[model samples]
Target: MATKRWWVLGCVVLVVAASALAVAQLRKRDFQAICDGAVRGGSLRYAIGDGGIKASDVDELDSELPFGRLSECRASAEDDSTGLTVAVGNLESSSLMSELSGHRDLTGLSGTSAPMGGGWPGVLTVKNKDIAYATVVLKCGRSAPHEGILVNVKQMLVEGEGNFSSDKRKRLKLAQSGAAIASDVSKKWECGSQLGGEVDRAPDDVAVNKPLPLSQATGTCRAMRPLAATAKKWGITRAASTGSDSRAPAQDCVLSNSKGDRVYRLSALYGPLEAGFRKSSSSLFQVSGKAGRKEKNPGWAWAGAKCPDGSDAALFTASSIEHSKENKRLIVGAEFETKMLGAFARDLGGRRGCDDPSLPTG
Candidate 1:
């Protein structure tokens, strides 16, 4: 009898192991399908500079969580006004408790709409009032059949109002419903990565002109160092090349006025209303040439910080005037336009960036 019991136990173990392995394989396949679908179906043009998420890797925000399984994976195809939104979820599991404890920092995320459950076993809160939400829980890390993602998304907007605390809870729950439209659609999970395609025509805004001093220009004719230093600090290893000169390598340059220099440019892009609501964007700026030296229209270049890390490096060039045209133009373009006013509406939004909470003081 004892011998038979041992045999049964061994067989049970083997079956469990096999089942685990099969589950892992299924999850991997599912995730891959999700990735492919995202790429094929999604579209959020506007090539990002170096910094956003990568193509193949999953961003923290996009991964499964709290412990659950994915029931659906699809993409939306819409105009730039309303981008595609993705929805994913997880299978119910007891292990979710452990996973939530492990990542408690992220779980009871403060400043969101709903207050964290008071020592509640499993719950999440959201702050954004404009959207609804959904919830699924999963463990962290990618393990075989056992590993997966649980995603909840904004489904729809809430209509009625309640008491302060009740309203907060309702809004939070609404925000958790992940069934509605998704804005800012893209294929990759990483928010830092850039997706190349087309962007809608951004609206215009009052021009801003931030001019720096002209004395701080550094580097030789071929390469500039001041702006290069800034780029390097920002993890940019490559240098920007411009002009017709092939013999000389690409280099970095800086913009200067008689006053001190400001490295980064801050700007905003208003939303659809075009009244006041606007997002922010960032860029690396460079200006060359002299105030009146009669050189090529004083150098004028603006590089957005939207790429992956340091990939797209474009140089600005203007025709050299015998004296007046390029000189006067450089002053206006570099000093009055690009530096201060900015290139476009979205340019400002790109500079402001997500998660940067500080409001721009007028």
Candidate 2:
């Protein structure tokens, strides 16, 4: 009778192990069932862990949208904590969270970012240790939505103990998994986008553009190091590249005073709203040589570059932060404006593979 009891106990342990594996597989299937396969079941499982979430993590934010063309899926825990979200929409009729707005920023992210390689013209950005986002716009034909379809993926860890909090490896895995989900859905929807290979790494902003002493500037700030002495006349003593070396469209660099306050900003606009930014900004800026004259503007200067997409990308150098120091413009900002504008344009053009851009007529 004792020997019989021991055998029964061993059998119970085996049964529990098999049951656990079955449960995991079931959860994966349910995870991808949200929104007609737009959500990849394995994506979140790969980024985080299989046991970290339940099968109920995937849900439709809105049920009214189409099954496959445009949908939104959220990965969340039962206790109201969301791990990630993916949304799709038409470029013109709807707005993707990662698209460029009228502001100088494209995604409003500053912590870290990198390209989603594998031919997809997309980018991934990490806002902090807890939040990350990915963006991809597919050039679909037939005008179903009458334009391209945009996909935006965002991951926010509100659970207070996400693996990506400080682990650089986990952060990169998050980027890759986010891109993978978007890529899968884009392809399944029949949107013919040139999606490419997997993302290898996503470097932090400081790594991408570490702030250095003004004299020891590098990357975007390196080209303008010669003008560091001139810019110092306006209290600028530090230089840093806010832009990524990656060929991502929008990029910029910042100049700061000893107090770490940004005294000047130089930016390159290459998103769909590039023209809109230039037109709207004309309200505050007189835009030297607007009518093709040799006139000049002291507050700011802008240059135009013809992008490979046949669009005009604008580059600007602005000193709004130090506007009160306008008296120094005549003494130092004039030459500084033109030189910085050129420096920024060259760096941006080279990164994007565009021919040399034209300097502002003013």
Candidate 3:
């Protein structure tokens, strides 16, 4: 009898161990599924979970959360002019909870706090009579450590709206509905790795003072760091090279003022004759110049104009070289009416070359 009892006890222990192992494996698989989905841009929908709220605008706020190991997903919906934004974050419960409380105080928002069922805490705050926001931090009772979810919702009243008193009931209902949906989503939430796959190519090949390859340089404008003097004078801190083509390897460099409100583009083109050049050059002329004038540089052309905003602009184009027998032609042009256009065009022409060079220094 003792021997039989021992055999039965051992079998029971084995069964229990197997069950525990199976559960663990399932949990791991679930976490991996969330991560995979996130990287594929499915997290936007997944974050909403089973909530009946349909999101018309969904955007990934960030690949990683600001605190701890976390990821965030954002979704928004608009009814007429009113809008609601939902933001979800997956992280540690304790960390999320602390962050939410801290944020509430830091933002100077008057909020009502309450404990939610299932280890969740929520805060609701109203920003004036037209806007309201709420946050809920939830923790699943699963075996995972530091696992938590955060949901934030913000609602904006339509334009010309009065106080919330008129629609208090409706507002309360919406808030309650949002909270319930958030809780449901929290229960299904799982922390995942950084979202999105790496792009196959580098984001930008253009570098200050560094020349790009002909293939990369052609047809694409490279943004370059602006010189200090140029940046200060016209607030032009950023510059780019673009518009290279096959027929003649033509290219253009664009410069933006500090406010990024204005832009200047410079280009050089080659053709067989003046008539051939005109065919290619007319577009540049029409776009930059309504009037023309003789510039200081020999064989160079210049034009000036007043923008609708009362800002001045100018365009400069000139034939760099003329070949009679071969009928080969090279035209250089710069467009900007600011005080700095003359100097800028001269500098650009000096640096014109096929080899990608580092961005010019101030």
Whole-model Cα lDDT of every candidate shown, in order: 0.26, 0.54, 0.35
TM-scores for candidates 1 onward, in order = 0.21, 0.69, 0.31
Model 3 misplaced stretches (Cα beyond 4 Å):
1-65, 68-79, 91-103, 106-120, 190-362
Give lDDT: candidate 1, residue 221. Answer: 15
lDDT of 2 by residue, 144-230 (tens): 433455566666776565634356675566667666776676666777655657677653343234467777777656666777777
How does residue 336 of candidate 1 score in lDDT?
Answer: 30
Task: Give candidate 2's whole-model lDDT.
Answer: 0.54
Please list the residue runs of candidate 2 whose C-alpha ends up more than 4 Å from where it truly belongs after superposition. 1-9, 33-36, 46-48, 52-69, 77-82, 93-120, 139-147, 162-167, 206-209, 214-222, 242-246, 258-265, 273-304, 311-338, 355-362
Question: Which numbered prediction scores highest in TM-score against the true structure?
Answer: 2
Q: How would you order the candidates by TM-score, starting with the best? A: 2, 3, 1
Q: For candidate 3, write residues 1-362 as lDDT tens digits.
A: 99999999999999999988887565434432222123211232222222223333343454223444333333432223444555455543223332332222211112212122122244333444566555554444556443545556565666674343234443443345345545445444542211122112111111121233212322323323333343445344554442322211122344443443223343332111111223232232222233243344322343222222232122223222233457433222333232233443334323332222122112
**Model 3's TM-score against the true structure:** 0.31
Give per-residue lDDT, candidate 1, residue 170.
44
What lDDT tens digits, residue by residue, belong to model 1 across residues 180-223?
11112121222221212221221111011122222222111122
Sliding window of 10 residues with minimal summed lDDT for model 3: 198-207
